[model samples]
Target: MVKQQQGAGHSAEASALGFYYQAFFALLTLMRQDTDNAAVGIEQLDDVDLKVDGHNLLYQLKHSTSDAPPVISLKSKALWKTVKVWVDILPDLTLSETTLHLVTVAKLGLDSPLIALTNLEAERTELVEAMVEEAQRVLDARAAASKMGKALPHADRVDGCSAFLSLTDTERLNLMRRTVIQPGSAAVGAIEDNVAGHLKLLPPEQRPAVAMRLVEWWDRQIIYSLCGKRERVIARGELQHQISAIVSDIEHDKLVPDFEIASPPRDYQPDGMLARQIQLVDGKTSDFSKAIREEWKAREQRSKWLNGSPAMAVTINDYDLVLEEHWSDRHSQMVEECAELDQKGKCQSGLEIMRWTHENAPSTVRPIAQGWGAAYYIRGSYQVLAIDLKVGWHSDYAKLLGDAE
Candidate 1:
């Protein structure tokens, strides 16, 4: 039993270290995306995994080597600790910009329904219930242990207990929502792949040498500190400094001037079709610009339909009419279906209409609609009829698409 526990401990430690390495690269990739002067660190005294500019993001990364997926429960010790950390930081000014994110390489535990929660109201209720339960559990356990002269499993029980009790319902909900879950191995894979792009973004002339240097520098300075081999504690700020130093040296010795870096030319529009289409429709770019400015001025009046009944359903046919006029596939089955639906007066009504659209609409439209979180189709004919049939439909469609809620 003792040997097995020790082996398990080693495995967990190794898994955590692997996640940190990936997370470090992920943070680095995000940091290099812009010219913003920011600081990022790991295992900082602030209980934050990454801090950039004024915003702090805390990530609790989890992975399982077993066939079964790793699970994180709201009632778990790990979650309570995370909550405690946020509570401790709440009074600090960074609290406004700080966010707590949970990144895991597996699905959440079955007991945690918070994963499926989407409605803001429902999420708030659940978070409040969970927070209250966890606070009671921890405080009770700590009190019992103290009375028995026994040591509890968690440290900082005194401060954590106080902070947990002190947090209001609104504060708890805000913190809970900020605790985003990045599920599955896909999240880690995305980070690793994106880091490759960041590496490619390095000056083309010194790319290979600079890439090799970064790898060596990270291995020498960062990896040891992360894995707990180094005796003295190294804050993330120190790690950031070391990285900047290495990159600076490489640039000074082997790279060209910052001004010489190739950049996309101004007004270097990529879409020839859009440019020509706008010119043909509005007669000039100035008219196109004026149209956009006028639309911004009357956005509220134009979006009145969105404020109507949530039950009001917008069918694929309605979306097609609004969106497919300029579509390329004029004679496709999708175009035929749109024509058929328009003749049948098939505004959003039931599953049959949904099934028809799902089956017949172009492969592209259905997914885009589904991404807008349309579980069932609603009749949006009223909205379609009210809007300017020629040009305003496009703006209305854009507005509806933006209203993901």
Candidate 2:
């Protein structure tokens, strides 16, 4: 009994490994079937596991940790059912291009009765008769004993068995010709590695985002499988759109960044290259030094004006506008303009920036606002690497000048 139990465990493990190989094959199939101009998606399903270009490809992947038995033949219950289904669906002219494949990690079953046939077309009638005979033999032995009822539905048993027996010689030949038998197991890991290489072949700028999108796509595939949703194929383009939509939704609902200000202000330094150039080109008492001093003094005066009132902090109501202004214009000019406004008390609150942002903010610019914080500041020198709105504004504007209240 213990020996028998051990054998069963080994069998179960092999079965799991085979299932894993099948899934990997499906993923690799999707990668192969994906095209830039067309959309396609893959789902775990029946004999036809992949659907593309309006043609269905039935992928029958079989794998084993060790070599399978010698002479593995296509004479099993699986083969018969596949044959029956294709026969029943033969009348559907739209599905004429559907192809059947028998992929296995094991050698062909040489001893199986179907192995002797040399010419499938010439011996088509004989082949059908033999297949029907084999099917009935299994049904008589297994179905009557109720041992394989779950696998062989009682309702479709007569219909399917009859269909296979009735298929003409030409029909049998067609089915036989369409069938593809790959008897050797493929390198599973190589499949994924090849896919990774393909992804890397994409444009360098797009590779990173596309890689992330593939991850999201894989995750969604797992979730869908877990939910028992079977065999739903989609265009790759459509899948990409779905993944992007998911990312957008996640950003909108869950990725809202927080803004907080510290009282003493954060320690920072000016752009090192600019400072070094200034030190090397202009002495401390030179005109450059005087200009630097004036810029510092202006920044100091503006900071005081903004942070002056113990009762209030300067606020920019139009963060988007302020962000846009800083991005589109020179930082020094923006600082000068803001300083002039502060002198007039118009810059007491960020209401102007906020108002401007509200009026001009486009959907394209909304993603940049995700990183804004209470510590936002502008510097004439390279004190802080600010977001340049001219290009893709990858940086966020710190909104530190005022309290949220």
lDDT of each: 0.44, 0.44
Count clashing residue pairs in model 1: 3
The lDDT, on a scale of 0 to 1, for candidate 1 is 0.44
Q: What's the true lDDT of residue 344 in model 1?
A: 29
Runs of candidate 1 exceeding 4 Å displacement: 1-8, 11-32, 45-53, 62-69, 116-123, 138-163, 185-194, 197-213, 220-405
Residue-level lDDT of model 1, residues 103-194, one tens digit each, is 54556665676563323234556666766776777778888998999987445344555576787877766766655655554443344344
Query: For model 2, how does the per-residue alpha-carbon lDDT over 186-248 read when each residue is reduced to its tens digit?
Result: 544344454455564455544444444454355456446556663355455655575456455
TM-score to native of every candidate shown: 0.41, 0.41
- Against the hidden true structure, what lDDT does model 2 obtain? 0.44
Candidate 2 runs further than 4 Å off:
1-20, 34-48, 67-71, 84-93, 109-163, 166-170, 187-190, 197-216, 225-231, 238-405
